[model samples]
Target chain A: MAEPARGAYRELVRAQIRSQSQYRASFAMDAALTSCVSVLEILAILVLFRVTPSLGGFSVREAVLIAALCEFAFQIADLAVGNIERIAEYVRTGRMDTVLVRPLSPLGQLLAGDFPLRKAGRVVQGLALYAAALVYAGIDWTPARALLAVTAPVAAGALFAAAFVAGATVAFFWIDSGEFANAFTYGGRTFGTYPQTIYPAWMRVLFGYGFAGYQPALALLGRPDPLGTPAWVAWCTPLAAAAAWVGAVLMWRTGVRHYRSTGS
Target chain B: MPSAAACPRPGPEPESGSDFGSDTRSDTEPDSGSDKNTRSAPDARPAPIPFRDSARAFAALAGAGFRRHSTYRQATVAGVFTNIVFGIMLCAVYVDVAGASGRPGGYTTAQLVSYVWVGQGLLSVVCIWAWKELAERIRSGDVAADLLRPVDPLAAYAAADLGRAGYAVLTRLLAPLAFGLLFYSMYLPQRAVTYPMFAVSVAAATLVSFAGRYLVNLSGFWLLDIRGPISFWMLILGPLCGGYFPLRFLPEWAQWLVWCATPFPSVFQVPLDIAVERTSSGVAAATVLLQIAWAALLFQACARVQRRAVTRLVVQGG
Candidate 1:
């Protein structure tokens, strides 16, 4: 059963890629535009840093590294569950009935359908920014640090994807809850780009504890918090991510059980 | 009824109620005079009698748009909450960045707070998100009917959008500003001239923004899918219009580029400067004039492009 499900997911992705390739011009334009937008955001940070040498005691290079890691994790998570945004559309158009009748889990089916190749632009941009930050930040880059760098974004991506799933789950009750979800999903991405110390204590507590992106960003940067957090806390990213994922899965199951299908 | 018969049907129902002209006919149905004039003779229709006919038409369409958008109360409330959340986050960043510098980029902490909050309030007003309704209508062949209408499509759209902006100001704008005022030490403009100048600038900015988006949506006539251009516009315009940060924070050379190249700065940044007293009254007055100039220029450009597009549609028998 697992093998067949994996095969079906792979086939779905393959078919989507093939269809997307036919619109190469549109795809290239979209990808370039996405990258351009990401670059503009980085430019805003550079402008800010021009006036001030440090943001919350982190050097400009460290700040950029934090932003890149946050963006890298965000783009990866976006690629995974970006289709969740369409759940509201599905509900509105009564297409949820089709998914309910399918043998596969509705969440699994959604994950397989509509793979967003366009987001590759953001991932590529994030990688480039990450490399630049790594070179400039003058990190010691020990084996452990290098290993942490590689794993941190993946963990952060899982947590962010969980945020997406949790947000999508709310669509079962309110079809137009994208903004509410965005307050966490996109909001988390924005918050993660900055050092958590810059925020008010209450904000730091809310985002840092409620969302998992903050820990992983600090872990990737190998930086202790300006707010007096212990260095060992950086290593807790994976645990935080796992906890978030488990919670997201349970919430999704409840949402699925409670979903009264909209008629076709 | 010949022109009505000739008008092509929009293919398939649009998925969302946001689509333009979806309920436009029904809203305009009670105004029997204009409906008779439009249906009776397309070519023989008299020149528009300016204020009487067009004014009434504009008011009716604007009222419908205002009422239609007001119905989305839940979306408005959610948007307000999101804005306040982001507002607090942004205020924190600005405060942190201004630490000990007193006034980075010549803006005091209070001024910076006011800038962010005002920018938030004005965001939906100068929204750069290309209204995709026109583009979708063009793709679905619904624009054929739009083109045959006795009224100029550009004017009609501008009127409807003005109504939408009015509604947004009441629902979306005040909450964020009030939130900022409550939490932060926001700077209010002290000069007497600032209030009227800011009002004029905002109205002109809305019209200018509508014209820019109108041109973008009109591209759907040529490009079957316009998502690429729309995304590009939002990305470029949002920062240029100072939605992200005060344009003054940018280097002088970049500021010059914004001033010379685009009317974008007039959209949000100008009104914001007036509100924060960042500009002298002379400069504020000049900025308002610039917004009016952009509005007139862009509205004319929209009319010209629309004429060309409609002619192409007619020639191609769309």
Candidate 2:
């Protein structure tokens, strides 16, 4: 069962790549533009830090690492489930009916179909920023710390992917819930970039403990929480990410069950 | 007169109506009264070359745009909610940065809160993401009909965008301001003239923004797929326009670069400064003047681009 699903996914991705390759120039231009935009977004934070070296008690370099980590995770998740952003359109246009009839799960098919190679540009940029952050942040690279660095983004990516799925699930009810979901998915990405202590108490609780991107980021950075959370809490990123993903999948299943075809 | 020349294809054989074919066909034939109420047909009668008539036409388009955008009640509500949420988040960030200093980058906590709220409110008003309509029209060749219309396409689109801005101010703007005012210690300008100045500055900034967006969408004529250009514009505009942070916080050299090289500060930052009373009256006046100047320059540029685009379309048999 897994092998067939993996084969199907591979074929879907390959087909998309082949079609996209025909418009190589257009694709390259779009990818370059996206990367430039990502770089500039990082530049905004860097420029801000020029005036004040510290934000929420983290140095500029440390803050950049957090941002880079968030961006890295977001890019990976976006590359995987970015098509979830189009779930509203699918629901409205009755495309969901077509996906529902397939042997594969709608969510899996959507993820496979929308896997974007263009986002590799952003991922590369994230890596560069992450490297710079590591150099400037002056971390002692113990074996455990290095392991945390390697695993943090994957865990963070899983959480972000879960957020995307949850957002898409909302489309089963409200076709225009994209913006509402953005309050979580994009909002979470932005929230994770900053030290969690900077937010209001409610936001810190909602994003840090409830959503779980912040603790993971802090953990990966080997920094204790500015809000004075336990140091051991950082290690819980993978567990938190797994829990969120499971919750999101359950929500998605409920949404699918409730979904009615638009009859287009 | 150009429309006349463009229309005089031999016999009443409809201009090869592949692009915008549905629109022209529906215009010639009466509506079937389907559930989707197609817009009223364009006047087949030739337009007179009078200034008053042009003004009336512009007003009609603007009014239609205002009404059309207001119908998205859900989007408007969601937009307000998003604005409030982000506003609160950013306000907290700015407040935290202020730390014990109580004034990061020369802005008091109250002023920073007000700036975040006002910035969120004016965001849609200034940095419009609605240029997709123009780009889509261009790509679909629907702009052929638009070009053949008597009024200038640039003015028509600009006027319509101004209407959208007006509607946004009514629906999307007030809620964020109210939210910020109720929750945060927002800074209000003390001077009696400050309110009026800010209002005028905002209106001018809207025009500047519209003109810039219109030019960006015009790239669709050349690029065919304008996603790249649009993304590029947003990337450049967001930071320079102070969407992310107040331009005043940037280094002096960066401020100089923005002031001298780009009209971006006029779009969001200047109006924001006026509202926060960061700018002296003299500087506020200068900024407003600069915004108007940019609008005028951009509008002229749009006209030039439209001329070239139309020529290209005509030559290419669009």
Candidate 3:
């Protein structure tokens, strides 16, 4: 994380942005389409609520708050590190060899390679939902609560970013691991978006309710944990995120060491 | 659905269909004698490929596609695992939603559970997305190689896709369904005949799905990139095709319009409804026939477009 290496990463990202922006119309259309997908997903939730008054004891507004938080965190993580999902292709095409020879971190280079700036549309939509959820949930915004609101998504984003890294690591061991990785990465988003009480006990234990952003979301709304976890768990996002990050870094290092090049 | 660019990309125009190579002549049967003459005429239209030739090639290509897909053992396992996970999440949410509302979409809790699981199982079988092979080949100009073969590219690709679908039915479709049955109370068909009818409906649905994807891939001949159309297609078609939930969840008028106006319902809802016996026998038969009609209509469109696209490729010398 030296300054020069950090600048190199910035330059790589800038090059991608410039190339993407050069095609202004396509970029605009991609951004607009990304937003449209965001709207449709939210609509799916709203449509479900139309059929029933509540799901897992949560009203539509409450569920939207959880979903927004999870999606926001997911989008941020996806924007930051999701491109690693392409590791299968990189490995298959022997691009990983080229990446390994570079001075910069392979993970950092892969992330900066195709940054998908257009995903900002979903990020904006997610923030809009969060702001609306804040109003709709009608919480008594204390200073601590206010602080949680700002930091929750960042911490959750770190957690989801870790999930992305950890998921991508599967590719190094097994090249065709994208769908398996999605089982948690996207699956975790689906799990986190709803009240954790609705899931069977095993899912909650397996994916873990905390890293999925549910604990923090519940904390923000001051909702009691139906599974009866302590209130202190709400403040554990940073710690959980750090642990997950350490685990993911170790997993990624192991995967990198395990790599056998697709020798040409 | 429409793009600004409809003309072929600028490239060296092949002066004749002969430029496609010897396969064109070798494959055209002697029985297509008069039709063969027109193909060699200057600025003449290529004759429609004979049906028998296409059918034979279709079977072979489909088998090849099936075998090709079967080789991806790890991917199949991963895909099945992913489907099961989604099935569980959707079933949990849907069961609660259905349980609370007392059959919101006229489906009982059991029926809704069946709907969710079957939808998940069929998600890959029907394949609402994840098809970019043809478009990629088109972009790479590899589709010209397909044209160089004796078989029609449309039939060849569609057959291969059907083969892939066959592989999915054995692995992706059955695994989640077995998982659903293991853990949940699933709906069983009321009548024995429903099974065969449902199978037919699913087959037609696969054809309809293939035709839809084929046309989308064919768009690559004109557009610089097919990503926009592909995304737009998925954005609109995914939910309409019942990958999200049952179309019965839609208001009655909208549901009626979707069934009447689009092929989306034929892809998932029709077969699933038939499988669950949600509709009466008469209505189920009608929907199956409706799916067949859509399949035929879509394949006709595919053939027409494939012809035009091959012509474009020839003229552009791709």
What lDDT does each candidate get? Answer: 0.73, 0.72, 0.75
Q: Model 1 off-target regions past 4 Å?
A: A18-25, A209-223, B1-45, B314-318
Report model 1's interface C-alpha RMSD after superposition on the true interface residues: 12.9
Q: Which is the leading candidate under TM-score?
A: 1
| lDDT tens readout by residue for model 1, B1-318 | 000001101111123334454566654433456556555775674665445666777777777667777876766666666666667777777788899356778898999899878776777666544467777777777777667675678877887788888888897678889988888899988999898888888889999989988898887777756767676677677778877677877899999999778989988888988999986899889988989998899999998998888766632333
| Higher-scoring candidate on TM-score, 1 or 2 | 1
DockQ of each: 0.37, 0.31, 0.40
Give the Cα error of residue B213 in candidate 3, in Å. Answer: 1.5
Choose the strongest candidate by DockQ: 3
Candidate 3 residue pairs in clash (backbone atoms < 3 Å): none
Docking class of 2: acceptable
Q: Per-residue lDDT tens digits of candidate 3, residues B72-120?
A: 7888888778778877888888888886787867778888778767777
Scored by TM against the true chain B, the candidates give: 0.86, 0.83, 0.82
Error of 2 at A64 (Å): 2.3
**Model 1: colliding residue pairs:** none
Q: Write candidate 3's Cα lDDT for A167-223 as tens digits.
A: 889989888777888777777777777778788888888886355557887888888
lDDT by residue for model 1 over A1-264, one digit each (tens)? 588888988888888777776645555676789776456656777777867777777777877777777777777888888678778777777788888887787888887787877777887887787677778777776788888778877877887888889878887777656666766777777777776777878787666532344454565566666677777787777787788889889988888787776653
